[model samples]
Target: MFKADLPGLKEEVTVEIQEDDRVLQISGERNFEEENNDTWHRVERSSGRFTRRFRLLENAKMDEVKASMENGILTVTVPKVE
Candidate 1:
């Protein structure tokens, strides 16, 4: 699962989860309030701190990885048991 929302910031979020292929990543950033009478506003969001890694399979079950974020939307739940 993947979610993104960073336009003016208000609970930024980022989540990723995969089972069979082993992949669990999480990201979060929220801090907005600096735009008004400055003549400068051009950013596609995505700043600082961002990591992602995944390459696994074979009964992957990293402690039932799970994540959650409100407002901005960020939910990652991986559960693959066989």
Candidate 2:
């Protein structure tokens, strides 16, 4: 799960898995603020597309992989096939 102050919902994230290579990619774009020519004493905010990738186990059930976002947290489930 990814934890952060992100903008957008579960329906707006990109999640993909490659069965042949056992690779999982999770990506999302965050957009929720306009600078509006404001001066910043402390700069602490993020925007644009965030991407993460991982190499799954050989036995991982790539076809059943799923992703979801809730309350700025991203959850990805990759079941192990026995």
Candidate 3:
């Protein structure tokens, strides 16, 4: 799971899921705006590709996985089914 806060103008993000070796791989990108100016004092932030892997249990339902992004935050829900 990845977590970051973007101040002002909520960020937009996307998530993609894939399965491999009984594990689910989640990857996505978060888009943000950058300020351009002639003067710069310091820069401290992170942006780019990100990924997370989750081991699936025997009862986990991969087909029922759901994901959504809102207000600069992304949420993924994987349900366990019988």
Candidate 4:
């Protein structure tokens, strides 16, 4: 199980498992939106593409992997084969 903090994002995230290798991949892109007549005194937010990969153990069941996002958090669950 893995959890990541991803705020201000919806339907912009993806999770996948590589078939050739037992690797789990999480990727997403954040774009900056400039509103009309918007003045910024300070800029602190970030925008870019991010990709994270992790090697799964032999006992991990890739077919049973699940992912969900809620309240700026992304959760990925990988079940182990018994």
Candidate 5:
């Protein structure tokens, strides 16, 4: 389950697959949006870059991997090589 509090992060996210080494890399960054009004409040959300790397198996099809995000949920599909 790929869920992030970052709004409008679809364009900044990236998914890369290295077929030679069978390594998959997923990365993205979430920035803080400045609010017009500043009031005394508590901020628990943190802004930074996030990355994930996964090693694929020999039967995995790197070219057929698909990713989609909806309602802050990201789903990745990996097809096996036939």
Candidate 6:
């Protein structure tokens, strides 16, 4: 299982698994939108692409991997092979 705190990214995330190495990958991108009508005093937010990968154990069930995002949190569940 893996959990990630990804704020402002609801439906812009992607999860994948590598077939040969059994690696789990989670990725997403965020874009910053600016309104020209407003004068900005300070801008602290950022936007870019991010990716995280983890190697699965030998007992991991690659076919049953599941992922969900809720309230800016991303949860990935990888069941163990029996």
For each candidate in the order shown, give its overall lDDT on alpha carbons. 0.56, 0.71, 0.58, 0.90, 0.75, 0.89
Put down candidate 4 lDDT per residue, 1-82, tens digits, no spaces: 9999989987899999995799999999999866666576555678889999999999998889999999999999999988
Model 6 has an lDDT value of: 0.89
List the candidate 3 regions with Cα displacement exceeding 4 Å: 1-16, 29-35
Q: Model 5, which residues run further than 4 Å from truth?
A: 1-8
**Where is model 6 more than 4 Å wrong at Cα?**
37-40
What TM-score would each prediction reach against the true structure?
Answer: 0.32, 0.70, 0.60, 0.89, 0.78, 0.87
Model 4: pairs clashing at backbone N, Cα or C within 3 Å:
none
Task: Provide C-alpha RMSD values for all models, in order.
Answer: 7.6, 3.3, 4.1, 1.4, 2.7, 1.6
In model 2, the clashing pairs are none
lDDT of 2 by residue, 2-79 (tens): 333445456657888877788888777767566667575554566677887789888887678766677867778888
Candidate 2: C-alpha lDDT: 0.71
TM-score of 1: 0.32
Q: Higher-TM-score candidate among 2 and 5?
A: 5
Worst 10 residues of 2 by lDDT: 1-10
Candidate 5 per-residue C-alpha lDDT over 1-82 given as tens digits, one digit per residue, 9 for 90 to 100: 2233445678878888888888878889888756777684665666788998888889887778888877666777778867
List runs of model 2 lying over 4 Å from the truth: 1-10, 35-43
Q: lDDT order of candidates, best first?
A: 4, 6, 5, 2, 3, 1
* lDDT tens readout by residue for model 3, 1-82: 3343433323334444455555766565545436788687565656666667777777777777776555655566778775
Q: Which number leads on TM-score? A: 4
**Which candidate should be chosen as best, given lDDT against the real structure?**
4
